[model samples]
Structure formats: C-alpha cells, structure tokens
Target: MPKRYSPQVRAEAVRLALEHVEAHGSAYAAARAIGPMVGVHYETLWMWTKQALSERAWRAQRGQSGVATPPAG
Candidate 1:
C-alpha cells in the first residue's frame, strides 16, 4: 500500500512546491525540488500544484460573490 501523508506533511509539500515555483518558474522543476519532503512523486506534486492553483482561482471567483465554497475533490 502507498503511504498516506499527514496534513502537516501535505502543507510542507505545498510550501516547498511554491518555493520551488518562485525560484524556478516551472511545475516540473518545482516538483523535482519538492518531491522528497513528503514522499510525493514528481507526477503527484504536479497534480497537487495544478489542483492548488485551480482551487485558488475558484476561491477568488467565489470571494467576488461573497460565498466561499470549499474546494471540491
């Protein structure tokens, strides 16, 4: 079975991915840099980053409507 990550570990992976994006400006590069911290594979990090960005965009849209719905899986 694959290992499950704790919330703290997920947060750390996200943080590391963001830092890598800031430094390298590419998801592939960011994934390579951030993958080890939480045992996320590079492909998984890419998917997570894409999901995070989409969620952020959705929240911004909902914020304009004054209704902040949680992200859907």
Candidate 2:
C-alpha cells in the first residue's frame, strides 16, 4: 500500500506548491520541479495546490460579501 501522509505534511506540500507556482508561473511546472524534491507526486501536488488556491479564493470572495463559502471537497 502507498504511505499515507498527515494533514500537516499535506498542508506543507500545498504551501510549497503554491510558492513554486508563484515563482514559476505555472502549477504544472511547479509540481514537476518541486514535487520529487518534496517527496510528492507531481499530479498529487498539483491537485493539492489547486484545492488550496480555490479555497483561498472562495474565502476572499466570502469575506468581501460577508457571506459564508461552501466547503470544498
């Protein structure tokens, strides 16, 4: 079976992915470059970053409108 990572590990991976994306200007590129170094698959890291960014966008939108954002899957 594949190893399971803790929430903190996942969060850190997402954070790293985000920083990589910001620096590289592409999530795919960021994942490809940083994933292996971080011990995560590129596609997995991409998905985590995508979800984190979406959640942040949702929260920002809700904050602006004073409404709650729906939870992401």
lDDT of each: 0.79, 0.84
Clashes of each: 0, 0
Q: Give the per-residue lDDT of model 1 (tens digit) for 1-73.
A: 9767787877778778977787878877898878976688877787778788778789898979888777778
Q: In candidate 2, where is summed lDDT lowest over 10 consecutive residues? A: 1-10
Give the TM-score comparing model 2 with the true structure, all chains together: 0.82
| Residue-wise C-alpha lDDT for candidate 2, range 1-73, written one tens digit per residue | 7777788878888888888887888888888888898888888888888888888889999999989968668
At residue 67, give the lDDT of candidate 1: 82
TM-score of structure candidate 1: 0.69
Clash pairs (backbone) in predicted model 2: none
lDDT, model 1, position 1: 92
lDDT of 2: 0.84
Error of 2 at 19 (Å): 1.3
Cα displacement (Å) at residue 58, model 2: 0.4
Per-candidate TM-scores read 0.69, 0.82
